[model samples]
Target: MQPTVQPFFESVTGTVTYVVFRSGHPECAVIDPVLNYDPKAGRTSTTDAHRVVEFVRQHGLQVQWILETHAHADHLSAAQYLRHELGGAVAIGQHIRTVQSVFKTLFNLERGFRVDGSQFDHLFREGEKFSIGALAAKALYVPGHTPADTAYQIGDAVFVGDTLFMPDVGTARCDFPGGNARALYDSIRKLLALPGDTRLFMCHDYPPDGRKPEWETTVLAQREHNIHVHDGITEAQFVRMRETRDATLAMPVLMLPSIQVNIRAGEFPPVEENGQSYLKIPLNAL
Candidate 1:
């Protein structure tokens, strides 16, 4: 079986959302979709989501699912918006309940907010197999970047979310809630163990100045050559480097607002009692 994937690069987030289909089939799945929001303007637009919809319509691909690798901290998900426009069920990891539990306290959400993960249609489990067209994927529960992170391995390609980045960027940080440097070390090893030629599609990448965006690479290349945490990099060394780098890093530009929306399958917070939607910010809270 063969798969066809279209990667939509969001320049704002440096995240790649893929629309993938089976050879000779019109059914498809969308991974990591983004909703276009401008904080400066406080308005939401569907430019990004519409692009994927038009592509699906142009190709006559029936979207069956909208999947999120985890609750993202960097961008608002377009999953709900796309579901409204395109018709599909949205899914996330079973451990999203953990994320919901933690963030609810952080944001002081009402007790009515369900932290049990009923928000999504499917709470996928590790090693569970699902299909997108003719391509079958096994959920690899790789959780170090986030407790709920799951990499979907379909045929020769692995949608590795933020667990691993493009080889040049090394991997995702293990400092977030439920994230662990040592755990990330073990999780990546599982991915690298795939066949040498397996394609690893990363969730995000911040290309160096003047360089073009690079978001896809091979597992063998990462196993042999990823500069930060490749085969030879020890767990101790990686943890140390990761800690040092995270110390200097400011939280993601969109962290506070994004997580609150994303954990609910990309739905915005309640329209405030003031009759407006507001994103809460706890100053110095990261």
Candidate 2:
């Protein structure tokens, strides 16, 4: 069965949130939803997430899962928000504990903060099978953009999180902690090895040269035209290209705040006596 997919593009962060289900099926999954954040004012709004809520209601969908492709650094997640409003299990790759440990140490989070991925409702192992109504889905561990990155294979479509972008945009950078260029290359190969016509959905798009942002591509398109890792490009070549390009890139604007909130499953840190939650910025700690 080919599932129905509705995409909500958050232009500020160029993130794409998807609501996927089968036709005439009430159960669905929400993938990579974004929560609006204004770094300058340190305020968060649900304006973006509300769009997803509206869609679910309009379709009479029962959200079975709020899925995170990974602990995103470029934007805050709305998994918790969507779960609260729409009801679902919040899940991510089981390797998220590894990511949580690394960031916990770097940020010096509160002593009570656990790095065991307990914050999320469910942790998926590679190839684990689940269901979104009648649609069969599996989790693919594609960890290069981050140690915990996961891609969801639902029906004929795969939600590739930050692993490969539009063919013209190449692929994801691997300079972040726990990110491995070689592993990313291998992961991409695994994805490309899928049937050529398999649909691939991007979690984000950074369009260039005045083109409108696009979020869908095919395995054949990526295998043939992805600038950084087309068929003939070797693992060594991709590693070199990825490493060199990653060096020239700047840290994402919301990396600091996004990590803090994302690592906690989209909930703010516990409020202090003053009744305020704060995100820490460890100077010179990247």
Candidate 3:
């Protein structure tokens, strides 16, 4: 069955959150939900997440999974908040342990902090089969932008997380810790290998020129028009282009804060004796 997909665009971070479910079923999965953050104040709000909650409640849908495509750097995840409010298992790629370990050391997290991926209720393996109600789903390991990145295939639709953006925007940068441009190229090829009509949903979109934000495209469109990796683009060429482009890019504004929270499954760092949570910034450490 084709799942019904609803996208919510968070403009501040150019992140797109999706709610997917079967038409006649109540079970649904929420993917890459955003948690609002104000860097200046180190504050978090649920304005965006509430929109998801309202939609779910209005549709009488039960969230079966709160899924993370990867531990994102551009925006904080609303997985924890949505799980608390809607009651669902929070899940991510099983390899999130690698990402968690990297950030845990960088942030010098508390001694009790674990990097076993236990923070998430479920950890998906490559090609792992699961379901939201009767709608079938599978996890595809699409590491490039990050070691633990995953794209979820629900029926005929694939929620491609940061692997490919709109054709005009090209693709995601592979400059973060453990990111590999070659791996990204291979991953993109894997995605493009799907059926021509397969629907692809983006995790984020940065509209260029005056184009309005869009999050859905198809395998054929990308294979034909994707500026960076169109049909004739070789892996070597893509890697070189990716590395060159990544070198000129600045680190995302919310990288430090987002990583700390996301690695913990969207929960903030442990509160101090003063009852406050703090995110760290390691100077000169990129």
lDDT (C-alpha, whole model) for all candidates: 0.86, 0.95, 0.95
Where model 2 places Cα greater than 4 Å from the true spot, the runs are none
lDDT of the structure predicted as candidate 3: 0.95
TM-score of each: 0.96, 0.99, 0.99
Worst 10 residues of 2 by lDDT: 259-268
Higher TM-score: candidate 1 or 2? 2
Local accuracy of candidate 2 as per-residue lDDT tens digits, 1-286: 6899999999999999999999998999999999999999999999999999999999899999999999999999998889889999999999999999999999999999999999999999999999998999999999999988999999999999999999999999999999999999999999999999999999999999899999999999999999999999999999999999999999999999999999888889999999999999999977
Q: In candidate 1, which residue ranges exceed 4 Å CA deviation?
A: none
Model 2 quality (TM-score): 0.99
| lDDT per residue (tens digit) for residues 81-172 in model 3 | 99989989999999999998998888889999999999999999999999999999999999999999999999999999989999999999
**Root-mean-square deviation of Cα positions for candidate 2 versus the true structure, in angstroms:** 0.6
| Candidate 2 pairs with clashing backbones | none
lDDT, model 3, position 122: 97
